[model samples]
Target chain A: MTGVAALPGTATLAEIGEQAVIATLTAGLPPAADVLVGPGDDGAVLEVAGPLVTSLDVLVENVHFKLGWSDPADIGRKAVAVNVADLEAMGARATAVVLGFSAPPHLQLRFVRELTAGLHAECAAAGVSLVGGDVTRSRDLTLSVTVLGGLEGRPPVLRSGARPGDVVALRGRTGWAAAGLAVLSRGFRSPRAVVEAQRVPQVPYGEGAAAAQAGATAMVDVSDGLLADLGHVASASGVVVDLRRDAFEVPEPLQAVSAATGADPYDLLLTGGEDHALAATFAAGAVPEGWRVVGEVRAVGPDAGAGVLVDGRTWPAAAGFDHFGAAR
Target chain B: MTGVAALPGTATLAEIGEQAVIATLTAGLPPAADVLVGPGDDGAVLEVAGPLVTSLDVLVENVHFKLGWSDPADIGRKAVAVNVADLEAMGARATAVVLGFSAPPHLQLRFVRELTAGLHAECAAAGVSLVGGDVTRSRDLTLSVTVLGGLEGRPPVLRSGARPGDVVALRGRTGWAAAGLAVLSRGFRSPRAVVEAQRVPQVPYGEGAAAAQAGATAMVDVSDGLLADLGHVASASGVVVDLRRDAFEVPEPLQAVSAATGADPYDLLLTGGEDHALAATFAAGAVPEGWRVVGEVRAVGPDAGAGVLVDGRTWPAAAGFDHFGAAR
Candidate 1:
């Protein structure tokens, strides 16, 4: 890393070489009690307990993100947030993460260092150890991250555990990122609040454990919109979910963006994605503080009824963020 | 899954969409006892104990493999083999694997299915579970795999543990993949052994624990050729490694390919990479069956000496496997 740290300001990744780039990225990454062996080895070793919860996510250039609109740090932070959000949904404590990054060799050395800084920052905020990673070259800038969680002997709250009488609750903001995206898409960058949310999600960190302790029956991460994600719960639980549209008060930023973009506030709140809020179901009396009831679970009708309904009526829209979009 | 299965065999990935493609890939995947909850949830839950050893590897379209040179299945197998080899080097039992796959939407549906089938086949061979994965779109076909391993309460073999009197041993073939690569580079694909080795490394299964039980001091995966990988061990352990030229007898396939290609077999053995053999350091008397001694470790003294040498002389070639190649 001495070689990379001493290079000129305009140095590219190709100029410093892969070893130097990797060394620079991993240098001074703080060690954690959970990580027995960190980066620079064939593998990382972590102290573990009970069950392991793990998930994978990939962010591709021009697909999941655009370099023109966001800084590399923002993208790095969002990567950790998205994966940690999944672990939170499963009622597991975020433990550690390993990343695989690939980009064209023409990428700048400073951007690589900044990305790792962002990763370290987010992992620390999430109470996770940045245990290990790999770097390589690709035609597009891409990140593949895997988050590992530990249950600490508690049962994982799955989407299939919702009962007919459970109350649906949400712990964090929804559709704010979507609003931010709408604003950015319209070529406007003001309203810094929503735009910042789009760059880095304000995930409700410890609320997952709190919800689990409060005897929540099921949980989900609101990544694919409130309706779309809750639909997974309804389908998996074999129940009907009915949301109160009045419960969702569109934020001022969203309203402003909606007004300017000619987009529907309700549509953004119900169907926009990447907000990364935690959604869960609990007994009516068991809904804890900080979690507000937005809907109720009901038994499925004989016709198998509907999955997720708004105000007990079908809401017609594309389910959520379909990766293929109109290509399908 | 039914949507994906019912589509025309000639259909591209864009036609079936991400969800359907995911379903098709994960459909009917055999559940392992270690995987308490397999795919479809926010993450896979695995039953675990002791420390967790994990590693990540990324393979890009042209950087790691070429579509014209190999089948999608071979690429898939190689991806799993490469990551699992890292675990084997650490004296850990390979437990589970999670994949992040991305490719252009116009890619054929059959290739995705075949790739997954290959992943499953390799995981089974390695006694690892294909527990979870994510699907996305990128300009280049890419696979990022994270392998999870368990130490089962055994001390991990680290690269820094080799001592001056330790004997260097190897448990799998060296330079076969390189020989295969050389044959393929010349547009000659005969001599199926070496060619297949390039396409799918036959990683020695379960050798990590075998070496560990026999009191191996240090270990490394030979993904970066014998001499280069041993260099890591030498530098980490502050020792000088000297390999016997006569100790390494080139295999028939590699010899044949080397002769036809007019490439130096010694260079292939010393610098050509991606064979994925497990190299370990053990006391001279502790080298176990199925393991063959290749070199000996000597204490670093005086001018601090060279890291790795062949027959007590400096090896003049560049180490191995720079992803940026001449672009650097």
Candidate 2:
């Protein structure tokens, strides 16, 4: 959903104040039965159906996102989507979320209202509720979202469960978001789909549970590039993963962006993060529909070196997003 | 516990990197049965005993707190304490907390470690677990804490249940923290107890459940000053709360701070915030032990005005912390 556009004479946060801004941001959110108590209380009460699953992600103004590069609504949507991906990785359906927002006092109140609208839209798409949150003034804009999900009678799919001979499968596209970033960084206009991918990733949400039901041994959401994230599963399971580069064909859109920007398509596909793709280890020949085989889990060498190998070679260390060490 | 002294050779976050920093921050924390899955996964899995009570609060440097005025450990502890207070207001015991931290890349790794130590110490104090979190790089320091609690088979004590003839009671100190803040703001060395009160409030954590069991009608934590928070109860319950000035005597420490700072004692007592005290209304003459009677809840006036009345008159608006409107 497109959030309400900023209008002339829209009150700034300083002019209208915190209470009024909060009242506007929380107004007209659809109520849920699980949310016995909503915003404005000390805390919220949720009647979770089963065990609770949770994840948290923080988005800083320029570190995780650039305000000029994305709309306020898209920022809010992306914030929710990223946290929801964590829940899906655990084979849980998101039930509710609480957001912590900080912004400057002179910021437009309309921005917060629109951001909330976007949060509502994304939560609706993921079948989650915006139950409660806290808003405060800061020097820059920051959004912290914590999502809660319910594991309705299914065992959690952990990253440490893959066994030797398990086949690694991928359920969503890779490199599109990174390709879009390459286009934007170079001051070139890319296809709308590529740009949207960079802004708000469309996670294959329910497939996580489907994979679990289909007997996936281990699962992880690809937030830190395909190789880097799968390396987590490999390391945790004490196995070595050998990925076949040929298994992943460069998509036409990414190829176009690579030609336009003179960037390597393989770099985007292998090292680009925030794809939110589901990568899992399933029994050989048992990969679920909508998922394609990408690699195989094997026993570690006699030296006990556990890692992700592309065509049986070691990849670079720190190949994905490292918040403190890497330059954005 | 005193945090590790910043050594001459202390590593900066950039040098230590995100992965190593995270590893050091999470090492050796106690585990809990409810935490079926802990950090290092996509999310944490919590076997909530019953209904889930959750709240979120974000503390920004120079906004909600100042690094110069507070120790990093105390800042971490206070962040968890304030959020736990919200759950305590709901007659819940905190079970787990998730934290989101953002800071500049050049920040010391020891600072983050000490912050985590402070978080661990506070969570241990409250019998809660630090389940999972996310960290990123930002221009300024910010900590967002989300507390999850359980009601333990009891109904949540809501703010909307106060009826006419209910007596208002308070379970903890009112003015000490605010007085401490006054002293800190004035750049005067306050008493150790007073300064500590301001930095890390000692909440009457379990008194909320006791109040519920004792038939308390309405409840809230006195975070935004006595009168302001009680106003929430009054508005939610549609009843007028009248607080008597003579009923509360000026504490000796507050009186000393008032004399030293030349601030009005009544202003500090009435409008001071961050006390983390439990304020509730119970049946008249049936207030529980450890609670001092402060006021009474009465029916709305013939004019239908429902709010907190001090000495039978309306208090000034914006008397407490309003993040956007207040002149801090």
Candidate 3:
């Protein structure tokens, strides 16, 4: 690392080197009970149990978000939220996360520090530790997070476990992130709630374990929109998901966005991605408090294939977020 | 994901969508006994014990390696090697790895498939499984690997465990990768041994556990040169690492490269990064059979702060690779 510390104004990562950047990122990170040895070591030693669940998610510049629209701190927070959602989707307790960050040398040190702040903040909110990670130089800024999870003694509530006559319920926001994205895309930002929701998802953190304890038979996070993610459950479980039109009452923020933008509120609710909401199927009466019954799982009919149908039709727009489908 | 299958010639990831690409990368991945569930889920459920060790490493295009200098498969294999090395550094057996990869939309489908091949082959060699990961679109190709390992009721060998009078030893090749890099930089790629080392490091697999079992105190993989990495151990342990000049026997390939390129062989051996070799501090008589003694851990003197010293002075050249310090 450079002997000179990164000064306030014009300091870039190239001038300070990697070791210094790492030191800045890991400083004051929250400690966890499972972490025996955290950052500054070759690897972190965590007190974990068998049946550990793990997932990885990557967020890249321009592809995932434009720096012009979202703050660096928000990007950092969103990265952690999106990754932890996978653990939540599996009915596993979000344990710890390790971030792999790389950016151009010329990127401002301020951005890096702000991103660190966001990561630390989100980790605290999710009850997960930012245990350890790698930082290096790259052509563009990218945050790759790998989240570890614990399934305790219960079996993982898989996407393939949905059966006929099961009730599909959801906990957490749906159309809000898509509405936020739509608002941002149109160069409007007045609806602060939706905009913030787009910037950082309000993931239902503890509801994964709650749903598992409630005897949820199947689960999937609404990362790729409510309809698209349920489609995953439908395809995996070989069933048909019939979502009721009246079940989705569009929230006020989403309704406002819909009224102004001339977009369908139901479209946003059905096909929005990046919400990170928990969607699980349970027996008819097994639905827990704070969750609403949105749909029902049914055996695939002879005429119908295994898929998600909202009032017996596929989503009007594309199903959820497609990374490569979007033009950068 | 696009329903159109990737039908070989000239197909790119964008055309097929993320789901297809993920399915392609995860197909036929070798199963591990510890893995309760593999890819295709929201996350992988790996059966592990407490005291789990984990580390994340990222490799980016242009910064980490050039497409011209190495094949796609070699890049994938090297990515795993570099990450698994961190686990091994802690004397933990490499268990499973989840890769977070992103690449340009125009990247060849063939390249993606070949990289998967390399990743699988290396995972098999290291006795690890490719569990699960996320693939997205990015401007530059990046492979972010997070490796998980189990401690198996043993304590981790940390870099801070070195004490005064501990003998320093090395278990794998040091100068070869540097020599290979030097060779490649000069537009000549003959010396196959050194070139291959540069492409994919044959890390002294299983030696980390052996060192730990033999009561080796402190250890680190020589990823960022012997001097620079040992400098980390010295700083962490608050000791001076005094290395012997005659202790290092420059290999024939390094000698040849040194003779051909006018680069110092010893300097390459001492300051070259990315060797992925294990360096450890052991008691004088407790040095393992495969490792050769190179230095001794000494108490920091008043004249010298905690750092690595070659013979009696610092090396002539600047210490190992500083990512941002290099000219891209």
Candidate 4:
């Protein structure tokens, strides 16, 4: 090895080129079998049986999570969790994941290892494995996760399949994660529930496939607030969704946290995000186990044109998060 | 939309969270068939027939390419090309690609658009589609591409399959990309051959599968220098490879650039990278149509551990580019 002076662990990524940095990051990791090709190739291939569902998500440091607040492992878990939620939304089970990580050169190798370990833990929880990934040195920390899922011969539940008179239901908590964010952003001391929720989201993981098997017409994961995500189904399916706030009430834990944080319970219920809850429209009848009816889907009307209404009023907040928003 | 003061087409990515940035990037792109679910879910699902192959690579700004030297389109093409070449190395046909992009807030939207366009163009060239992707705000530019491929019933060629008496052959030009980098580093004006080669690499796309069908024992892509990549085959297959320098001649266009740049042509031929060419070892006999025999794989000897030799001398250059090298 050349006797180049090694910089401290805080060196900026700009000092190194991307390729050279990646080579260092992946120097001696064990390889997996499904990964026919690993990091150095143009793409990776895994041997698998059945139909594949794929999803991709990107995470930037500070923007996605403050390093001061979250450890590297937390960041890794969150990244994997969110992407796995996408597969759940498609009514599929995650089988494998591929990661793309970009960080500055000064970042510690231990941090990356811990982060990868976190990813592996989450993958194990989801009954999948990390097949392949890439690492490059960048100006800051950024992670992109792509997950593949398998639908064991079941038809995929799409957002565009809700029909008039369908009963809308949710299978998991809808606003706890957003409430947790609100608490954290306000600089409150660590509370077990809020802190745990913030670090790693709890998605009702297997409920998506359960919902699909139970004859759910359309489904989505509540990632960007309930009203906002429902609006996507409404617009796609050309239907109006009317949600009953009382029926889809905020649970006791979330209400207590909202009260403590001086946050609007209604805002958390209607407009909060990162819940990873499974929300679906089912044919009117008995809802599946672990699911509760929360609303109804109707034909589009002048007052509600492919939109969502909470307790007879249009949601006041902007429809979820947009990347190029003025705040950026 | 909130009437926040807009920075004049010069927004930095740091200001936006990774998720919001990705939302903006994927706002209006149409997805193809294999993309059962697009960017928003936990993961995107892609349709596949038979066994699947996946590969990933990450490119950080400044490290992979100088942003000042390369426009967004060039960066995009390189990212896709490198990942696609990995799939080709497996003798599989690329089917879809998912991208993860992170950049600071000050990045131009036009740059992102151009980058996307370039990705699409490369995908088109490879007869694959840009199925889905994620974009987010970051402190620096980071691109991570994951590619999936389909192998229609053929067994994948592996690095550990070469044996004694196997003939080592090459299917495409080697070292042109490394030569191009030399030209660029010297601040030379764009020459047709050097500039074009740098922008997009030309890998023998379908030859990996062709070589496999022709009963090749082992295969790898020449993304790192030919000698370094071949070393992987040597070590994995427990064989020693002896390359005949007389047989490893430089192509005409590359020779012209080497002469003009005052660089040693031999260095380009042996130690250069980013060519994405296919190098494989076949059982000695007739090679495939587009392949040329360059050496022979010999049994490992007590004195010589599994490695590569050039023209009867052990190659002294360090094996291929490592991301964390002192030069980086």
Docking class of 1: medium
lDDT of 2 by residue, A175-213 (tens): 888887887777766677788898888888788888888
Q: Mind giving the per-residue lDDT tens digits that candidate 3 earns over B1-328? A: 3432336746777776677678778877776788898888899999887788999999998878889988989998999999999988999898999999898877867888888889998998888999999989888889999999987677999999999999999999898888998999999986889999999998888888889889989999999899989988999999999999899998899999999998888888898888899999998899989899999999988878898998867777747787778321
Kindly report which residue stretches of model 4 are placed more than 4 angstroms away from their true locations once superposed: A1-47, B1-45, B256-262, B326-328
lDDT of 1 by residue, A6-91 (tens): 77656787777788878876778777888999887789999888889999999998888889878989988989999899899988
Q: Which candidate comes out best when scored by lDDT?
A: 3
**In model 2, what lDDT does residue A58 have?**
95
lDDT of 3 by residue, A1-328 (tens): 3433335535788876777778778878766778899998899988887689999999998877789888989998999999999998899998899999888889877888888899999999998988899988887789999999898788998999999999999999898988988999999995999999988999999899899989999998888888878988999999999889899898999999999999999998888888899999999999999999998988988767999988776666746676767321
lDDT of 4 by residue, A183-204 (tens): 7787863455766676778877
What residue pairs clash in candidate 3, if any at all? Answer: none
Off by over 4 Å in 1: A1-3, A303-306, A326-328, B303-306, B326-328
Ten-residue region with minimum lDDT total, candidate 4 chain A:
A1-10
| Candidate 3 residue-wise lDDT at A78 | 94
Using lDDT as the yardstick, the better of models 2 and 4 is 2
Q: Please give the range of 10 consecutive residues that has the lowest summed lDDT in model 2 chain A.
A: A1-10
Q: How well is each residue in B31-102 modelled by candidate 1, as lDDT tens digits?
A: 688899888889889988889999999988888899988898998898999999999999999999999989
For the predicted complex of model 1, DockQ is 0.74
Clashes of 2: 0
DockQ of 4: 0.40
Superposed on all Cα atoms, the candidates' RMSDs to the truth, in angstroms, are 1.5, 3.1, 2.2, 4.8
Report how far off residue A36 is in candidate 3 (Å).
Answer: 0.6
